[model samples]
Target: MNSATDVEIHAIKQVVATVEHAQRYELVEEFVSLFREDAIWTTAAGRLLIGRDAIAAFTWQVLPGAMKDLVPSYEVVHVLFIRPDVAAAKVRQRYFFPDGEPVTEEGGAPRCT
Candidate 1:
């Protein structure tokens, strides 16, 4: 693996920011738009979602009002460049109550990366 350029790092951060924004606002389309057509997404629940259509279906069913009393935060902790055009980003995800207390135990809520 090669070290990512500053520009690449910034782009990864922007993608994470977009995810945070989409989740915070429950914008399903915006969230799903981030995935490639062949992307595979594994949910926090350990469900394996294959392909963009599968992801969209699952997200559509769950994202609306999912954050009614909570806020989600996503931060890009690391990015590994596998090739010039491919990178894997590790994101830290946390959920908080409207009053800002971390949702420590909701649905087996452990800090996710």
Candidate 2:
């Protein structure tokens, strides 16, 4: 991918930061607020959530106690500009222990992606 304009870069970064912060803190309402009313969200488990309302409903049900003792973080691996007004971002999400070690196989894998 070529260089993104400053505005585009800043906007994308803001979105990423917001999402990361929301997830790390289990801020379900804030996370849901990031999606558009007509947006579609697919769960890692293959559940399809259409519209912000459905997304919010699902999110609220599972966010709390989801992380428990672990912390979640996102790293933006790549960004592709699909259109002038639209972009697709690839992210690497990982869970870590409070001491900063990566959660391992004993943790039984990360859920609620």
Candidate 3:
């Protein structure tokens, strides 16, 4: 069996934190770096975005429209080592909408490309 190294774990944690903060701050520069050039992001809105340019545009467009109280929380379920530079974590993220309704989801994995 293989496991994630300390550096990889730290990188992943930073990515998660950046995402959590994006709900409350401008994190396009930070969050964009965590992903590969050919990254793909699928939003809960069913929108699929590809490449850094498109993703950056998407980020800029959506950040201001997100719920004011939107909060993202995640749980690390399992980590599999694909390589020293690549790893995947199985996680579930809940987006809490304080003034409206909280959205809870489980199942499905978010792959960091």
lDDT, candidate 3, equals 0.66
Candidate 3 at 49: error in angstroms?
1.5
lDDT of 1 by residue, 15-105 (tens): 8899889989999999999999999999878999999999999999988988898888887878888998988888878888899888874
Candidate 3 on 1-113: residue-level lDDT in tens?
A: 32437667776777677776765565667667766889898876678999888888887776675545565566565678787666888766766556535554543322223
lDDT of each: 0.85, 0.80, 0.66
Q: Model 2 over residues 6-61: C-alpha lDDT tens digits?
A: 67866787888898788789999999999999999987567899999999999999
TM-score list, all predictions: 0.85, 0.84, 0.69
* CA lDDT for candidate 1: 0.85
Q: What stretches of model 1 exceed 4 Å from their correct place?
A: 1-4, 105-113
Task: Find the number of clashing residue pairs for candidate 1.
Answer: 0
Residue 65 lDDT in model 3? 53
Q: What TM-score would candidate 3 get against the native?
A: 0.69
Number of the top-ranking candidate, with lDDT as the measure? 1
Shift in Å, residue 76, candidate 2: 1.1
The 10-residue segment of model 2 with minimum total lDDT is 104-113
Pairs that collide, model 1 = none
